[model samples]
Target: MTMASIAAPARTAAGELATFCGSLRWAELDEAVRQRTRELLLDLLGVTLGGSRVESSSAPRELAQGAGDGQATLIGTRQTSSADWAALANGTAAHALELDDVTTESSLHPGVAIIPAALGLAEELDASPAAMLEAIVAGYEVTMRVGNALNPASAYARGFHPTGVAGAFGAAMAAGRLLDLDDERLTHALGIAGTLASGSLEYLSNGAWTKRLNAGWAAHAGIVAARLAGAGFTGPSTVFEGRLGALHAYTDEPYVERLVEDLGRPLQVMRVSIKPYACCRYNHGLIDCMLSLRGSFGLDDVERIRLGVLSGGALLVADPIEQKRAPANVVDAQFSAPYASAVALVYGSGSLESYSTEKLADPRVRRLMSVTDCYRDASLDAVYPRQWPAAAEVVLRDGRRLSTRVEYALGEPENPVPLDALMSKFISLAGRDDAEALADRILHVDADPSVRALGTALRSGGGST
Candidate 1:
């Protein structure tokens, strides 16, 4: 399908995305894509419910509650807030746990930004389940496309978080779809959202809560942009590839063809990885390596641990080795390779609980981190952004060395976690067996008249803090 059939003064990038978003239909989506949407939504709802109770979500949740107009339900809570507020609150919560679905190639977590906006607006406008799913697909496509074009590793090195930057477009696509905006209005929404996009990688160094709020902020801004556009507001149609636009602003070189390549023929959402561990996607392979070797050696038998990770990833999670060894807080610990490897080696697992303050205070974990070393493997740099590969070696007290390497993390598309496994994760995170029943309903959501049933089910079962 051509990006734009509309007569244009110029066939701009924004016009292409607008055309795609405006014309996308559920009927054109493959069965696999539809089923994947259900799986992604189920996981997203579960993680949002789990994240809602985290300490980081407190201020936003309180703010949303204070600003409430009952337009939408805040995933875990029975309380309601305006669509934008709800999106902000829930989107923040969704990302707080670091369990959201992600496309590693784009370095964007699709569900956190898109799902909150789509679900919030779906509840507010009483949009159908089919529409919600279509919105979700469009959101993923646009977000990943923009992220892909940016060359995420280079963007990351430039101190930008791709998710926070690209997520605005994703949320806008979803919101525009739900609003049923035409090509022109959807183009305006993209332009507005592009200007609104912003996020900093500084949070990685400080363990600040701002990183958790980036996707949520983008989601909030996108909803507002879409609403404004629907009200006939005008925005720059050349907002993408223009000299002063998002593409040039975010990356040194933008591969703009990636923005519309293959369009909807092969859905981008299918490429996303559902995180198994609650940490940065860059650290997943390292953690997986540690998890794999946990039973082979004892933490007490270890004298030192060494990690070889991609140079780009080292910039995010493993550099400044001392800081990684002694993280200041849970968020810091979550992104620390030494800390993560230590947690896995000492405890035989890494979960949401593993990054808690109490766990951070564990003497064994601390001692392990102190002995752990993380360094860049220049040899593995070529495989990065496509596959997050890691190599690990443990030096034991008895003069024995055990080593392993993992090319794919447990939840990567190449090594996917099964749907049943995802459902089990959903049940655990949602904190109720009823999540299974909800998953059943979500699988057939296309047949539902409205998305309100999913919202209703979401509010109940699992997580109330």
Candidate 2:
């Protein structure tokens, strides 16, 4: 058969990896790709540490305690659960704070959802850490390309969180790799993961904790699917392109071609944005611009703040409750543009501490937010969903005006966050001891045979917190 015929069979065959899993060499990846992966892993660790402290994390820790027997670590929660449950617990904790890294195309918290799931299962299997990283890299590529084919707006506009719905499959891909599932087994794992995919954007309207749970759901589902595949279960191979399949039901329709089109050639997670603030990724540029002016203008001198952005940016943070407008719940605060922008100008950036009710409702913070106005700017909206930024104007009581605009946020591939800053951020969130060691270990993750040794030590036998 010619090359084209071989490609055709590869696309249509049952155990073909649409069965053959390519062992992508780390050395083959460009230095930039490796560098980006390290940065993302670092940011993910920080977010997971902080998120592990959230109240949402408490439920899982409680359950793990009740189970009374298991051998898996719950991230920074200092608890233990069965391997699968540990994945669920850590995954939930990692995303509970909503500070996890997000990719533009994956349209999901790729790091929080996929990493914990992949790593959690890998630890249980005592799989080679390098193989685990390769799986993660492959999984990231699949999800983002699949998201591209998904035409996310179809479900997103209808109040469903598309990322969670699709992220399960990505996590499964990673699990399949670590489990060493051959073509048929990998196919079964992917298909089995389909039934486990769930979550809706309705939580945004209710301020529910489901938003955080969605990430954990993906991690859990992937682990379960992998377990079943290992147990000799089978599943349909054409999960995505089937007549009444995941694509037909959830998205406009999956562009099947994108699934393996450029699989090993490029890495999608490398392009992920490491958010500076806990608020929505859409609002970061405006927050960035505001923080820039706050330095020169001073918070006390500012009488009013105005944030202008593209339509998509505005939609993300516009809310119903006046409290949501000014926010009290940390979850709610992350969705409030006016509250976030004002806080950044008055303060600096929104971290776990910034979104507490006390901070959100502080009289001075409210005063600044009350004067804040969010508007749609035609120029910014023109290139949206691709390249869009924010412009902020600060009007001072002293009759002075200062304005700043950004075309891109700081942590994008183009304008990356420096390693020094990433390390400090990690130390702040995870404590210096844990952060420094994990940073060195994971940056070279592709080389290690097993991360279990490291994971066991970090299991935080603080025992039930």
Candidate 3:
């Protein structure tokens, strides 16, 4: 079939989005948005370096190592591979630590999927830093917009991971822009991406590694889609609003208008939240509540711990009470509200070390987890996907009830994590003595003539497991 035959009617959603992605320029971006993009890039790269040596990241890294040499860099290692393979390896590593940046309304990790693809492709094309940054912004716009329309709660219920699904579109846009595809080709890239989108929630059942792979695969598929489109491949233009489109296929109830609502007035990158704790974004507010009550009572003084949770996130963090209470491994613990709360109370912190195997087996943590109960709170859900508020009550052994609520968790846009704190996080993850210097380079990356030097620097710095 001809490209025109498969194209949607005039001014289709995909067409409009493609026009925006194609026309976006670095000079048109607000300074704040540009800075935020830089910060996010720094955050994602740090996380990738930290997670590069993880057991879950090993397979993809090995695969990339043997995928044949090219210009793209495999983050945290002195290796080069094809752009798609490098994106897969780096994306997997970014998500492995569960510390990647996440969006509020969309409820997905955008940086994990978009940054890797943008960075890899930019390096391969020898694209300027400004071009790459513009691509990154375009990618975030498409990913978050599609995610918003999916109604994250509904998508999660259907056992679909929004990041993997929406991320494919975002990656394609970023890659297509970097590849200098025209508006028509960019539309086809999105259409092709719609068919490639996929990510299942089955990993929740056994703490499997597929969760990390979702982000990797999304990035890989995006580059492939863009490349195919640039090579004159055609895809349906009604990829978003059609009867059999992504909205209908992946979600029970999708807010279709959200796909193009308020097109980039403020930019989606500003809405992204950097993760303070190394776990599910759903559990961050709960952890905040737990930490706030930590100094108030001794572990033994607590009779029962009741947590107010968002109904939408209940399945990922609260449901299957037994499993949540007794997380089998790091992956399970990362998604369990009970485990996150208990660990925060016992350890007085919820850092990556808090989720280690040793901490998972701690009798004190286990005892505390048994007493913690997560219940859906309408009050908390009212402003969800926008605020993510949480509440917790401690019923003491002496019948005293102490309660507290968190309107905004640290690292959120409203309650932003300080630059010093963000830098500390980056240093800890980058695991190199020159991490601060590297971060400086990343922040000013837009001035660089090309991303090739950045890749060389990343390889030289390396990263810790």
- Candidate 2 residue-wise lDDT, 46-130, digit = tens: 7777777778888875765576556566777565566667767777877876677776544566776678777777777787766
Regarding lDDT, does 2 or 3 come out ahead?
Answer: 3
Query: What's the TM-score of every candidate structure?
Result: 0.94, 0.88, 0.98
Instruction: State the displacement of the C-alpha of residue 420, model 2, in Å, after optimal TM-score superposition.
Output: 1.2
Q: What ordering of candidates by TM-score runs from best to worst?
A: 3, 1, 2
Note the residue pairs that clash in candidate 2.
Answer: 16-19, 129-449, 161-201, 323-327
Which portions of model 1 miss their true places by more than 4 Å?
1-10, 461-465
Model 3 Cα lDDT, one tens digit per residue, 1-465: 766566545587888899877888988878989889999999999999998978889899889989998888898888889999999999999999999999889999998889999999999999999999999999999999999999999999999999999999999999999999989889999999999999999999999999999999999999999999999888778899899999999999998998887888778898999998999988898889988888887888988889899988899999999999999999999999989989999998889889899999999899889998989888888998777999998899999999999999988999998878888899998988889999999989977889998998898876432
Q: Write one digit per residue (lDDT tens) for candidate 1, span 185-240.
A: 88888888978898998987789999989989988988998998888776778777
Backbone clash count, each prediction separately: 1, 4, 0
lDDT of 2 at 323: 53
